[model samples]
Target chain A: MDYALNDFLMFTPEVYLRLFERTHLALEPWFWAVPVAWLVMALLLWRAPPRARRLVPVAMAAGWGLTAAIFMLQFYAPINWPVGPFAWLFALEALLLVLLALRVPPVGIGPVVLICWVAVLLALSLMTALEAGTWQALALPGVTPDMTAVTTAVLLMAWPRRWRWGLLMIPLLWCGFSVLVLWALKLWWPLIVPAAGVLIILIATFWPTSESPDNA
Target chain B: MRLPIRRRHFLLGLAATGVAVRWPRTLAGQHESPITRAIPSTGERLPVIGMGTWRTFNVGNDPVLLDERARVLELFFHSGGRLVDASPMYGSAESVVGELVERLDRSDDLFAATKVWTRDERDTRAAVAESEALWGVGRFDLMQVHNLLGWEGHLETLQAMKAEGRLRYIGVTTSHGRRHEELERIMTREPLDFVQLTYNIADREAEARLLPLAREKGIAVIANRPFQGGRLFDRVRSQPLPGWAGDAGVSGWADFFLRFIVSHPAMTCAIPATTQLAHMRENMDALYGQLPDETQRQRMINDFQEI
Candidate 1:
């Protein structure tokens, strides 16, 4: 049990990064639909009615499902054994998202918070592409785990305190796991993942309920 | 470690006078008989160069990488390698090796060796069965207790398997210079056929005790991390090889580093892992040509220290 972090990581940074490019290649032509899903989610979150806004979590659930199936199970599990259990965790998160969508009331998130979340998404996508040294390897929200976790955490912050804490479990777990993996790979730029997770937890806990209708 | 004045003067004289020693060159498609060493327990001989599947062979299910790694194995066999060592701890490497070995049809030539690495004693037989299913080979030539985890129970099962004619060899392994005292105690108490630990020019701690113990106990020694997980190359990347290195058939750093390890009397073979065909070729080249004698090994140690 006294194993080093590098002992669990069998592949090199080069091989790990190439996984994104290989994933992109595997989903070619139909890959265009991924960005389209992102745009639709953004538009629905920004302008839709309160009842329609419930679709946001439903959409996020789809993102989690895709990431678990395509990225974690297909591309990563082959190289890293622990990723197999991680894929099941993601699938469980997707099921939880569906439950949240059905049971929880939709909270009205402000335009400012929505815009900041979108900015965070775009910045993460660009940073991932730069790290991979290719635009084609961009880790978009629905197609990759890191961005999907970040987006899900931010969206879950709009819920009431009890629901928020329960729903944030998987995304937080994933963010912490991602931080260790990136740190072990010696890549500094991708630490943005856990940072964003911390920011979401802070905003969800400390932001004044009187100032924002979403916290009500 | 002081050198004899005459031998020192001869080496310095070669350096000072710039005497060019002809290094043996083995080109691709040219076959030279590889050097072999006898297993201590049984006189069955294995080539000095064996293949290791650590980070290199864990390429997963990618067709392109599978084919590429298959070609690397192909080159290894073409260069006269037989023993291939793997473990269940290395993700997907066992399955990948099994698939590639079947594809190349080299199972007959392969001296397949793998390890049982789990904390549960009851799971040892199941783990070996899974490995056999993955490797597609009916029986493994060797099965080791990786890192000495659950060693007592696993070793008992392995002893039974050997007695049942289900396995040819049983041994224990540790790497990165960890747990040497425990390994030493096991070597003394257990009836092991082989004892693998880290041995290289950089990490010579094994030479002090475990290696000498292995020699005395008539146990075969497999040297893992012969290049110190590829860190030794980084140290000598910018430095030039000694002028007299070619006199011992040292053409490149791989040969220089590897020859120094396998040249030891106690070492049965050194398993070096590589992904590229060119690097595999360089590693296998160490199997051919003359190895450094006792004086030359010290000279190699001296040269390495200066770097």
Candidate 2:
């Protein structure tokens, strides 16, 4: 069907941004633990790559589940009918992450790269939260879909497994979807999501997989 | 030939029914009743200022937003507004309007209008049934073929439903200045009570053909996107109204833009959608006092162009 970008989005930017605040309030107090857990996991991944390999994906899986339940189902689905399928897509990504956790080999990712990834993800989350005009509406990794997808894509780039492309599919699709929605709403800051995804893909494709010690 | 007799009877019936309400004076301080136009076919008078549920009323199931929107609706009805337009394509808007109308207990005054928007020809009846269920109105005052999607099948079914007393009126709609030729064709060939298209001071393409055709065909023209999807407000945010605007019953930009459309000789109503109660009040305010005549409408066009 021939449709304009405006046709796909039925809510205004004000209503769209308010979703974050409402979601945060709906899951209050307990919501604080989500970012804390994500921070601890990132610290472990940066400092101790070997031990954190299996744990990181599992934590990310849980984040995907939470995003599906809290954000997609509870908040977004009402405003956008397609969000119901998006919630299921999130659940599928969660399942894929769990599978990755089970099968992932112990790979060594350098501390510098890991820390940079952590900082980037953290900055993106804070930027999104601040745009909503409140810290409580923080779009934390492993809690919200955009940050969680970007974090997963970047993390998978560190691993040189050929099958990692399979895990990257949903995250990439979601990033593209987010870009369209944000662009339609005239929200420029959140465009960093798909930009980061593209940058990571380029880096992962060009970087010498054989020479990198992380491949071991 | 029969139009004058029908119009006379319609006016007499309106007097007998006493359905019209006395609207307050315009912001320009003019003493005039709220502007209402009679349906060409039935001569039922509808207030010219209608509400639209496009991007504004799709608040989902949020209680806070629902209440906020209820207040907007309360102000609309209080200001003598009616003829609320919605469609199945607008997410949760139909349900939200249904809920608010039920809560406010103003269904009797509401000229409930919604659309059938499905690609499947067989789904036309089902879509209307679903809208009826969501709106809790038993039957819609007007059922339109949204964007003319599957209009051929939907219009046929809608005509049957009207005959069966399940629908009061049937029409087709298009927006953003799309498919006017097809819209004109439908108006010429079919017995439509209404035809909604994009019409505003900024977008006047409909004036060349659709509006004139509607006038000739005796079809009520519902002006959609009267504010150009709220872009007109953004454009004139820093600009001031013309000094002589009050003479045309324009107190603000909302009135300036809306009165231009609803003032057109062919227009039956203009539906301006807004989420804010203040905006709803401003939109409803356009209903009062004198509307711009052709010369003033031309001046409005010139003024907006300079902005």
Judging by lDDT against the true structure, name the best candidate: 1
Off by over 4 Å in 1: A1-4, A105-116, A187-216, B1-31
Report the lDDT tens digits of candidate 1 across residue range B193-283.
9888888998899989998899999999999989887779999998989989976568799999999999999999999998877688789
- What overall lDDT, based on C-alpha atoms, would model 1 receive against the true structure? 0.82
What TM-score do all the candidates reach, one by one?
Answer: 0.89, 0.90
Question: Candidate 1: lDDT of B98?
Answer: 94
Q: lDDT tens digits, residues B171-202, model 2?
A: 99999898999999999999999999999988
DockQ of each: 0.38, 0.35
For model 1, residues A1-216, the per-residue Cα lDDT tens digits are 134676566776766776777778878987879878777766766677667778888888898999999988998998888888989999998999899888864576557867887887788777667877798778877778888877777777666667777667777788888888887777676667666765676676554432235422
Name the runs in model 2 displaced over 4 angstroms.
Answer: A1-4, A46-52, A205-216, B1-32
Q: Write the per-residue lDDT of candidate 2 for residues A1-216, one digit (tens) a residue.
A: 135686568887777777777777877878788878876765666556564657878888898998899888988888888778989999998998888777764365666876777788778887666676778667777667788778777767655557477777788778778888888888777667666766665565555542344434
TM-score of chain A of each: 0.88, 0.86
Clashes of each: 0, 0
Candidate 1 lDDT for residue B289? 87
In order, candidate lDDTs are 0.82, 0.81
